[model samples]
Target chain A: MALISPSGRLRRTPFSDGVEAAGVKAYTVYNRMLLPTVFESVEADYHHLKKAVQIWDVSCERQVELRGPDATQLMQLLTPRPLAKMQVGQCYYVPIVDEAGGMLNDPVAVKLADDRWWISIADSDLLLWVKGVAYGRDLDVTIDEPDVSPLGVQGPLADDLMARVFGETVRDVRFFRFGRFDFQGRSLVVARSGYSKQGGFEIYLEGSDLGMPLWTALMEAGRDLDVRAGCPNLIERIEGGLLSYGNDMTRANTPFECGLDLLCKVGPEANCIGHSALQACAEEGPVQQIRAMEIAGDAVPGCDRLWPLFDDGRQVGHVSSAVWSPDYQTNVAVAMVRKDHWEPGTRLQVQTPVGKRGAVVREGFWA
Target chain B: MALISPSGRLRRTPFSDGVEAAGVKAYTVYNRMLLPTVFESVEADYHHLKKAVQIWDVSCERQVELRGPDATQLMQLLTPRPLAKMQVGQCYYVPIVDEAGGMLNDPVAVKLADDRWWISIADSDLLLWVKGVAYGRDLDVTIDEPDVSPLGVQGPLADDLMARVFGETVRDVRFFRFGRFDFQGRSLVVARSGYSKQGGFEIYLEGSDLGMPLWTALMEAGRDLDVRAGCPNLIERIEGGLLSYGNDMTRANTPFECGLDLLCKVGPEANCIGHSALQACAEEGPVQQIRAMEIAGDAVPGCDRLWPLFDDGRQVGHVSSAVWSPDYQTNVAVAMVRKDHWEPGTRLQVQTPVGKRGAVVREGFWA
Candidate 1:
């Protein structure tokens, strides 16, 4: 692959200076901002991330703020996740769909109060859609992308590293919840949730000027914890069955197909934009869905495009992501398979860039 | 400075195979697609482009399709530019805005018929916004992104190179006007407008299968014209004063501030979503507007962020894009200057990453 060049359009994160000083090796563009991908090497970084604490510049997880008297009302109309019962400081993974039940973005809705919330988005400009709907319907709400950036601390030593900076109160924050913690005399929202299956916290850093200071503090404080700059590991994420929005699924997919049925509230009074279509889909069920597959081969190459899966030369599905798992001793892949062919132990052929490879559906992702 | 690793999320263009085969060295993601930034080198490509024809795989310019009984109505609601009189074969540069006179996207709206049109968009997801507005308004319009990718044949020898495969009728396609030209038994929309001062034609290649075939034919036929794979050059565009959506202007800007006053027809009949706020902005006039500035220095570094401009140590505005014009022998730049400092010959200090430099407002961009 070619090296990526710099442009003002592909924005820099708040921790860009720290990331540069740490010597980020590779990056992937998300939400028009830089997200570091590789530090030392993919395999080496993955191993270190599991053993020690690392700070992640996930600033690309842009926040779309909903503020005003009608904020909750507008929020409910955008997703089927039943935000009415969501408590303040609770983070709920919401599936934002269109009128036809197609996913627009799978973001975590951070409920701040009754009339103010933030949607920490994966990718795609969900704000434009929100603004358009708000304007078209004349909703009493303001929609915009705030300057807040999320810096993550992940791994087994995450709590230890965080405690060194924010004190022992940081460890008390429960999973899927956020609390206002004092740092440099200002309160910052620190959520005990991150993208990795490895335990961590994502601090909603508000001020850009404090980005470097906080990063430096974390690095200095965790000097004994083997702290390093890291990003979401592909090998670890696939093992944990973390579905990427544009890759693992797209607008053609519904929440049910992406194994996000737990997030949907399709009962009466759901009042979401895709309520009707999603309700029908939930009842009828998706004909095809995401599954974990194990390929019988050496390490597979990067999944740049969907690799077609065939049952006796007839296309049945496609593999969206794949990587060699050093721990698993096999190639783990994520694929969307047809109804009959999705059962565990079902054999299939994946036409990859290297060549055809034997694959079998797994019961579920590795723990 | 990091290399960009590929994933299924960052999409590949129809001509990606050909681009890679031609030794593409660098890329910059736009609209989640790999856009070739350099083939040999930026300077080498620019020098070659000014003298010979080059093929550009600008598939990142995704198209948002509007089809239904209320398509034209929905189109008019999206942009302040009057579209009632747009001819079927014409392409108009429309400024898509929200209700607050904010620039969402500056795309070329291609009128296919009275009830069908294609919006060739920039970086942001304008489809989601349009869909949200349509569904909210209950307009009888269906919106979606079609698989139409635009390939450019640019430079001085563009006409000669295009005539070999597309025939002499391609020469008759007036500026901003598109016509159906037969290619491999398929009629492709070829428009005589591209993103450069050097004239070119943009072929809206529809099918993914035909991407490489057309690319091969163009390369073979234009061998005498020294045709090579190329991309939008940063230096050439900065010199031409062509505004890049996310770089030079963002949602924070207005069309009038972008010097696109001629495109806005904000009279009472104009039913654009931003009509009222735009009318207000037009009446009040923009406080800061985009201007061409000449920096007194050699080539400046890649503008990864906005460099603040100052007059006697007081911040006045910022330069969004800047580059050394090899032909002009000076640094040409695009900046948003305050009303007071926007006049030609007005001097300012640009706080660049390398160092501070003397700058002066230019009468206009070099032709």
Candidate 2:
């Protein structure tokens, strides 16, 4: 296997010091940034995450700050999701798409105000899309990448460890919501959200200078809670059905195909680029949809390529992400399956790098 | 150093099989694809490239194809370079910028026709930006990533190796010019270009199925010529003063700052996105500009992070790309330097990872 190269292009996060100290074993590039993929090991980290608290350098979830009067206008034009009811301090999971209703990015749009918002983006460069939209229409919006970096505190004891650092006021923060809290005299946005299904908080560390200080504080406060530096574990996320943008989806797949039709407010008034296309898609439904599956095998090789799903000789679907779940004791996988094959309990054959394996569609993701 | 996680998102090129079979040692993710950085070590590959023929799987140099009536109109709006004078067979190095004159990308605009073009891009996702502009203005252009992969035949023996496979007709391809040539009965776009000081041709293999066959044929035909699988060398690129997009320049830079003024036609008539700002910039001149430097030291650490440049007490500039050039016998570098510190022969101190080193500005890059 070829080793990945290093350069300024593969950006470093603010919490790199703590990550290195914890001995992160591996990484994967996200939005052209170094996102720590392992520490201890994938399986080891997964076990620890569910049982204890972990600090994650998810700074790669870089914020695309949209300010000015046209910010909301441009926001609505980017996604089918109705944003008129979104209040300040609320985070909404928005699936952004192009004119053809194809998925561009699945980002959490954080509304600071009517005139200001930040789209905490997934893998692809959605910023360029947003900027291009703003420029094309000559809209009155200032689009730029803010210095805001999200540091995640995930696991069962996340709230407990967070309370130690940010105070018990953090406990009041609801899921998918943010609140301003003082850290070292600096008010920062602390949101009750994260990549993992595990209960946690993602602290939006605004300034780069306070990065090390905050990381240190969290480490000291969570000493007894067994807080360790970790990242978005592959096994946990797959078991949770958290579809990765580049892996589970790309510009080729529509929001409907990703089972995100519930988020699409497809209408003439939707104002998104894919409004008309999605309106038609919503009526007819997607040809294939994202589904959870269980691959029958011991440990399968890492799913670096798409494993084609077959029902007899016909190609039924493809499994994009798969990892051996230590807790579930099965190879949990996510795939975009054809209509008939997508029904729960449907049997399919997955062609993994090693060989073919029996797979069954599951109604819901593993806990 | 940690291992990079393998995923379908870290795309595999058509030549990946050939690359692995030849033992590609390292890669750097470019445009979310695997770009080979080392084979028999960067130094060894550098030496071989200068002496013999080498094949480069630069499939990571993804193309952003523009087709339709508004293709030319959209192209002009994306860059400061004048596209009006560009001919069908010519390839112009275009500097794409946003409204504020910030550099978006530095791609080679391949003019296939008056209403068709392929922007052979650098590291960044220039496609999103291009698509945004077209969609924003509701232009009649269709922007899509074609299944075109560029395979480079480089080094001193490039023409010799190419002629053996492509016939004597390929030798007529002038620099920055392209001609369609039959490879296995399929007409492929063969451009007299590549990302190296060593002369070469970039064959734009349109369909991926033919990827291995072409690679195998190139290897088989050039066996006696000592042809080996190679990638763009860091040492050669730095010595040639080639500015890497994410490393040496980014959105924070302008065409003027990167010494790309020769390519910028900044004016109201330019019709580019950065017209007004670039016009003003042309008059005022850039605050800082890219410069070549010779760091006085042993091989500097892999320049993954920015090394601050100091002049006595005050900071002057930053060296982004640096390598120990075996041919140059010095640490060749590319830097964005402050105006006063940019002149040739200007001495400055560079703060490297190990320690500070004295660096002097060079009049020209070491060939």
Candidate with the greatest lDDT versus the true structure: 1
Per residue, candidate 1 scores C-alpha lDDT tens digits across B183-286 of 99999999998988899999999998999999999999999889999999988998888999999899999998998988888877878898999999889989
Off by over 4 Å in 2: none
For candidate 1, the lDDT comes to: 0.93
True interface contacts retained by model 2: 0.74
lDDT per residue for candidate 1 within A1-367, as digits (tens), equals 5699889999998899999999998999998999999899899989998999999999999999999999999999999887767899899989999999999999999999999999999989999999988988999999999889999999999999999899999999999999998889889999999999999999999988889999999999999999999999999999999889999999999999998998888978788999999999999999999999999899989999999999999999999999999999999999999998999999999999899999999999986
* Predicted chain A of candidate 1: TM-score: 0.99
All candidates' TM-scores?
Answer: 0.99, 0.99
Whole-model lDDT values for every prediction: 0.93, 0.91
